[model samples]
Target: MSAEVRELVRTYLPEFPIQYCKSLVTDTTQFMSIDYGHVIELGDVHYMVYKNEAERRFGLEDPKYWVKRCHELETGKRKILKLEFFETFPVQVGKFRVECYRSPDKESRILDIVRGDSRFMQGITIKDAAGRNVRVLEIVNGRRLDLTVDRIDVEHDVYFREHLPGLLRRYLEAVRAIGMLHRHGERHGDIRRDHLYVEHGTGNLCWIDFDYTFHSYEHPFGLDLFGLGNILVFLVGKANITVQSLEGMGLAERLEGRLSSDDLSIVIPNRIVNLRKIYPYVPEALNRVLMHFSNSAEVFYTTTDELLADLEPCVEALESEYGRKPE
Candidate 1:
């Protein structure tokens, strides 16, 4: 994949330097995902964001977050720089305004918990020239879970039967990794599908971007639990099938008429929560677990332990029905 990406880069920028080409091996994510552009001077080295075909084709550094793809010139090492981005997002989760904070200090502790664990990104915080802390993480080269699901060629039914069962079982390792964090009194407040990557070398499903956290909360790990639920939905369905997407599937009117706002994801309103209604073949156990997030639920999951307790059996059943678990 790295070779293919570099080959595409060469086709785009024939005059691109060889050194720059080497840097792209680690920094292949579309430039739209970051606050890219210009050479940044941190304390010890300069951080330059790599250019790619998307950047050349669309010509957009359509930057969002303060993350940047960079190389340590002094070391010629690939690194991801999370440069001083902090946000306190106040979300109303029933009675609580779950304040999500993106802090480097908070993330450092999460990193500590997963230290020497291949299932998470490893990084250290360093104070820059003016004394602001900048997170410097080694660029993990691999496939994002979202991209991996997208690339699967089979239909959802085929994917669910042949592929998803194995992934669902493997996904528990990641689920439990978060459980370990929660047990240690920490939460990965930002648990988007893209934040997870399967590493090229280890094939470990590694979690990245832990800086977003809510310090004090009425509901501990509310965001993290919800985020995990969303990922589960994606995996269970083989891809995220929103209420809007159902129209294209020719099931829109039939399913939409039956759905209420309660049936939608509590966190993301348009995302379908009761997936089994659309894809009836979804295991009853898994569907029931997913339905917990809908507005129809009486009890909500507050811990990964509880989530895993219910989830483990459903996956075990899937493995039983689908064949042996992946070795």
Candidate 2:
């Protein structure tokens, strides 16, 4: 987290101020996952490789494709940089060899570019091939609270009755995070379990990985709202629930047994059902929130606001039911 420590950690990467020589250019056809990263050596000097022929052969040039590149930095530990981008003009231009270009200054400029992008995520250290300072962000580690629906044995209502409040809190946080991005006209294109990192200690939900974070896009809020709904269902152990299953399962019996069904079509694929099948006893007010999101009619909230609204009552219900605040 410190600057000295960060620089020391980056030494394994190609040292700063290095640029591609003209001769380095090749067909680049075989390089599938093309990258413009620098190769660092122990001498504290940097070497620029335009393309990895092997990677090209395997079709890595595409950006959305994720592949890990590991090399021993000066610290002897392998620093892993996940090449996550598509093959395109930017990559091609970046691959263009540049020897005469000022590597140090270029690195600085790239750093500036990175800093200017609000979509960029924090925590990891970035540097140019020459290993010049890019930008270092504050550490924000995501929490892991994975509760897959298939993993729970309790009936839906029982689980919802018991855990809905806490789950709602996390859901609200996710909605708010989405709203924050929406306010800036950005969208977390991919909002999955892996992308969301919750800070259990702080009751905070942090978004991670900006490789697919989108800017300059409208309607991102709607997409994000759908994603939040999916996530909320996931938390409540209904991510995998099906309409047929809900149909066959009696809502009265389900509520008696503590189960609630999710009917949000956006959250899943083609389904309409009530929460009762999963958790029959869920508070009517809370159930309405779930129903609205499930139906995509909760208009007052951007996905984030809806998420919190749905969750707050549940949190209060949880506290009153358990005699303690649910985490």
Candidate 3:
């Protein structure tokens, strides 16, 4: 079965040398071996060549056909009955892994945005054997800030203090990246700790996932700033207190029980309490900035530049005090 799939891959992409091939198995019954087929890697590129049975069942022979079907569904022109059968394969191009989109138009737009900005994950479009327009993006080799913070020893004051300067610097860089996006008249509608990546070795920060980004003509950018504040809270407090976490904690129920029925101001003071409780080591100056921005009513920073300006002084002070001097 593996050999057969390898032959299929070679037939489709004969130019590249096949480096490795592995059969993807779904189940093994007592009498039958249900092999989903082989995912073959040719040089730096990977392709999932489905078995004959799987191809007949899923109609995945022509990638573009399914992509067009998705477009019809999205535009309300068609309704899909069985959506579970759909699956996507990842391909590698150069240094990045490519996610092929069904809609050539959507893929083209994404590629344009990525190519126009260096802050975004680099991407390109290529036509597959079936002439399907596929989008491939460079895989970011770094850890998300949220995951990175979880691994830090925040409980140890000295250890955390020593590393705080570098963390603050990276945080500033992340903010600056967002500011750059705004200057280009784009808004990253979705900004979270996981979306911001600190590149390995270089320590350069890059933003990923632009599925929700859109052009905003408005000058005041608060939503992204609000996200930046949440990121700061994560960095300084070493805690993941997001809207999802709040929802899980029954924040709505608590607010209903405590606040007056007529009072429109729905303030959550306990958020600050939790930050201070979890990270007692957070400096007072930094804490003030976090609290001010995190509070929706404060209106402390209308733009990313203002937030960066306010944050720079605090970060610089921390670097001077705790940063290791060059030997």
For lDDT, the strongest prediction is 1
Candidate 2 TM-score, true structure as reference: 0.55
lDDT of 1 by residue, 1-327 (tens): 235435544554444454444322233223244333334455545555553212111234544445666656556678877666566778765445676677878887877778788888898877665566667788778888878888889888888888887787768899999988888988888898888887776556889888888744556787788889889988888767777788888997787569887777877778888888888899889999998777677788988889999999998888888885452
Q: Which residue runs does candidate 2 get wrong by more than 4 Å?
A: 1-65, 69-72, 75-80, 87-121, 124-158, 198-204, 213-220, 244-264, 271-273, 295-300, 325-327
Instruction: Write candidate 2's Cα lDDT for 1-327 as tens digits.
Output: 233323433554435333321222122222343344434232342223333222221235443222333333433443333332332121111112211111223223333344533223343434434443322233344444453334447766666666556656655656665566656545565566545665646655566444343221333355455556556556654544565554466544444434333353434544443454455565666666556555445452455765676667776776587544355
Please write out the lDDT profile of model 3 over residues 211-327, one tens digit for every residue: 443222332455566667767766765564543354565565554354331111112233442344334566777766775644333345668888888789988887777874210
Clash statistics: count for each candidate: 0, 41, 0
Q: How do all models score by TM-score?
A: 0.81, 0.55, 0.57
Task: Say which candidate scores most in TM-score.
Answer: 1
**In model 1, how large is the Cα lDDT of residue 306?**
90
Whole-model alpha-carbon lDDT for candidate 1: 0.73
